[model samples]
Target chain A: MSERLAVLKTYKLFIGGTFPRSESGRVYQVTDAKGGWLANAPLASRKDARDAVVAARKAFGGWSGATAYLRGQVLYRVAEMLEGRRGQFTAEVAAGSGLSKAKAAAEVDAAIDRWVWYAGWSDKVAQVAGGANPVAGPYFNLSTPEPTGVVAVLAPRESAFLGLVSVLAPAIVTGNTVVLVASESAPLPALSLAEVLATSDVPGGVVNVLSGRAAELGAPLAAHRDVNAIDLSGADAELARELEVAAADNLKRVLRPRPGTSWTADPGPERMLALLETKTVWHPTGSLGASGSAY
Target chain B: MPSSPPQSASAASPLADVTASDAALRRFLHGLPGVDAVGLEARAAALGTRSIKTTAKAYAIDLAISMIDLTTLEGADTPGKVRALSAKGVTPDPTDRGTPPVAALCVYPDMVAEARAAVAGSGVKVASVATAFPAGRAALPVRLADTRDAVAAGADEIDMVIDRGAFLAGRYLEVYEQIRAVRDVCGTARLKVIFETGELSTYDNIRRVSWLAMLAGADFVKTSTGKVAVNATPANTLLLMEAVRDFRRETGRQVGVKPAGGIRTSKDAVKYLVMVNETLGADWLSARWFRFGASSLLNDLLMQRQKLRTGNYSGPDYVTVD
Candidate 1:
């Protein structure tokens, strides 16, 4: 009997909700731990990185302005989509990382839970991170947390699924749009995740995913004046320091990778809080009289 | 059909002695050559990447500031608002008196008098949008009356929108005649013909309308009415610049260009300047030739100017809201 042929999927970069081949029309090969050939990932160039930043910046206003409840709903929807695509993610993760089926399934499960975890923090981030201040003057001063515009994230290479989700979900949950560079070698899972995101209620450009070498794509984003922040969770120490310096051009909030960090650990609010900015507003406390005079 | 009948070497006005027949006019416009959308867009995008930094950037920012026609065109516009806009136009950067005032203050025809009075003593020109403005859907007489009101009310410049419906319906003569009539009413004030290019739909149409407007005696062929879904994009403005450039080489008359909408940031304003500088050379880099029709854009330019001078970014609180 003739064997049925398997149809392989072509991986494309996700920018502005569309799956487009790299602007440079270049692709790099992805392989498993045993060097088994996978799909050719888009080798995104500086131009692609710039396009992604522009998209993220464009999506920043709508996403950041959305009510915390709506953002939470969108994030939870992303989790739901990821959950539905669990089998696809598990297979892709195993193939990409050469992990055992059980281990890959566990990683995929953790990633889904990570999204759900960050989804809950979407609404409560402001409450936990901001409060009213008691000033000595006759004034009502309240500080609220606001997203720091567009973020450029370098997803971890080793634990592709869990690490990518861990970095992405936190930044986007609190309303910031992100341009993420997926795992260089094990990028199939991230590319698959893009499909999940596109199907979810998450807006286009809110979380742009690029599959390429981290340094190649991360440099332009790090130096882009329009980018408000960056996550270097995947960069080596040397690359991290270089990116941190480049990010200073616009003073982007840099989240350096913690050495020997465990992707499976329950990440505290630090990642979400790191991407946020506190805006303290002061309003005059007028007297309770019809004259509206200050106390 | 090589060119538009080899325009008169020394025509007194832009439309002094051109084709008088509809066939000739259509042939003249249609014969001006079609624009290759891809090439034109690529050229505009390429020009947009020229990085003007440090001293050159500082100079460009200030030059862009002086070339602004700070405008407020809303149905809800009040005399008080016009006065405030006029004041801002006359002194764009209040904290630093050294900053140059914008070239003009653009308003509606009815507010021209108040706008004129507000900037009476200053050299800031009062530009009024006339000829039914955002949409030039009125009769010729009514449109001509609108132009006359603005011109009589002391408008140094009159920005009039072309009848897109007429132009799109292939009624070239009606659109040309309307612009010519508006030009006659404008008299001394410069006539800025708005193509409302967004409705024109294609780059080819934008190029043709540009030449048609210039050939109809437009002192400046402007893009958009600042009221369309897409207004005054870099590619559209670049095409208009190309038209002005070619028109001058053909007719020996230099026309100005104005890109009037959705251009808000200092970066965006500078990119347009780059397009103007490279496309038209240094000759069209002055306030007399190139103008930005925006009000909020001035504040952003001022903030950038402050950033350049003070070595730190300035917030909106540092500049006036208007």
Candidate 2:
């Protein structure tokens, strides 16, 4: 234990199964709840955001291309891992959010359950929310919720662990890879969450967490033409407005911050649908269908 | 079991009164501009020949029932009352289950957690009214925060009343931006943008509000808060349903329709169901597609169902169990 503790493993940005520091090589110290030095997290730069976009884009085809059931299985696996680490998160959240032990445990459980909930939704969203469209013509039309490509999330500052998990799990479970800006004041649990994801069967670059000032890193991610959507959850007023404006550059789907609310609320099916872009396909069905289908 | 004065003197004619009511309503609606040209014609075309059924699944039930009112529930002393109603489920024994259990349980920003907890692991979802709710008179920042807080608190859905004051003042863009801002905070939660039809004061306004909400990314367009006297009516439901149907035709996105407020009986619920089925078709039968927003209507539905199943009519006292 002493050897492992003293070894000083350099935590690098997890992108495409490779460990790399920010192109700027900027590192910021993340502190624990008591403001004690915990570890140095990458102060991801604009280039790093771009790099994450590349990694996410690279992984998107294969990840989103998989069957919804397969995605559900992978997400379920992540939920299982998250459940196993519930205690660790409870302790971290207790310290991070200044919540009571019981409250922290409940939050951790809710966060884990959220993961499970989203895991279940991965395969069923289309069935419940999307279906065949009865068009006037002979076209076999259907509408389905599809991943909106690489998503960039700004995890909420409060309710650090749960918020981060809530945003990330939903995004990834729906096959949208994410670049998350971990809560500035509380980045420990986020990195810890990342560690869990690294081991959980979640593909590399499916989620990339960076710990730094939101304005410093978030703007690039929001404005990045490659990114499809920007979830501005933890950003403050000024930052949220700025990100909202920047998101317009690419017309990125922007999710503004929720007012003073925590992520412990019952998440309905809306979050999953929000990150989704509905694609209605119209396939012209002619008279040839009956003859080919007949026995 | 006592019918209300036979709706007329004739006991054999159940729908004679309805026909008269329909005719009167049609005459009243026909005088309004564009209504006679587009709205009335459209509504008549849709409601033609389809008799309103009495069962829970009846088309009339949908039209008549306004599931639950979020603003009223917000002020209710026992926040869990709606949740309990939802917990009881839609039972056939009106006397046993009280009201039919509204289509959904509505609550406030903080109460979403309580509602969700009470209705946890149940079919009924916890809905929170946000974006300053009934008034929609708040800063954009405040409204966005309110919406986000509700979703974060575990609200399965959000009912955000539009800034009618702004809309009425012709600040269309402000109203649009407000809805869009709330839509942003909604994240993954379903957003039902309320037009506050009573305040809008006209069918044309209702139509415009419905289009704005749908175009601005609303998953559902809702009518009235039930607080206002001029709540959801068949006329408003008809207009909004047409708008929703048209929006679907144009965008291919199936936005849901919720006619809330003033609905209080199984009979009312059947009316709304009839309107939806006749106007929107079979696809709108599910809870996801359609919802009633009345608190008392659920009991009425239950009572009616029980009466139908057991051949014994229960009084209102026995039906209003919750």
What's the DockQ for every one of the candidates? Answer: 0.07, 0.00
- The sequence of per-residue lDDT tens digits that candidate 1 reaches over residues B128-220 is 999888888899899999999999999999999888998998888888898888888888999999998888888878878988888788999
Q: What DockQ class does candidate 2 belong to?
A: incorrect
Of candidate 2 chain A, the 10-residue stretch with the lowest lDDT total is A1-10
**Location of the lowest summed lDDT over 10 successive residues in candidate 1 chain B:** B1-10
For candidate 1, write residues A1-295 as lDDT tens digits: 9999998778899999999999999998898889988788889988788778778878988999999999999989988888888999999899989889999999999999988999999889988999999999868899999999888899998998999899999999999999999989898888888899899988999989998988887777786767888899889999999989988876789998999999899899999999899999988776855677654
What would the TM-scores of all predictions be?
A: 0.73, 0.45
Residue A165 of model 1, lDDT score: 93
User: Highest TM-score: which candidate?
Assistant: 1
Global lDDT scores for all candidate models: 0.88, 0.73
Tens-digit per-residue lDDT, B168-225, candidate 2: 8765666766787788888888988888888876666676667667767899988877
The reply for model 2, stretches above 4 Å from the true place, is A1-11, A286-295, B1-322
* CA displacement after TM-score superposition, residue B315 of candidate 1 (Å): 13
Best by lDDT: 1
Residue B42 miss distance in model 2 (angstroms): 80
Candidate 2, residue B280: CA error in Å?
76
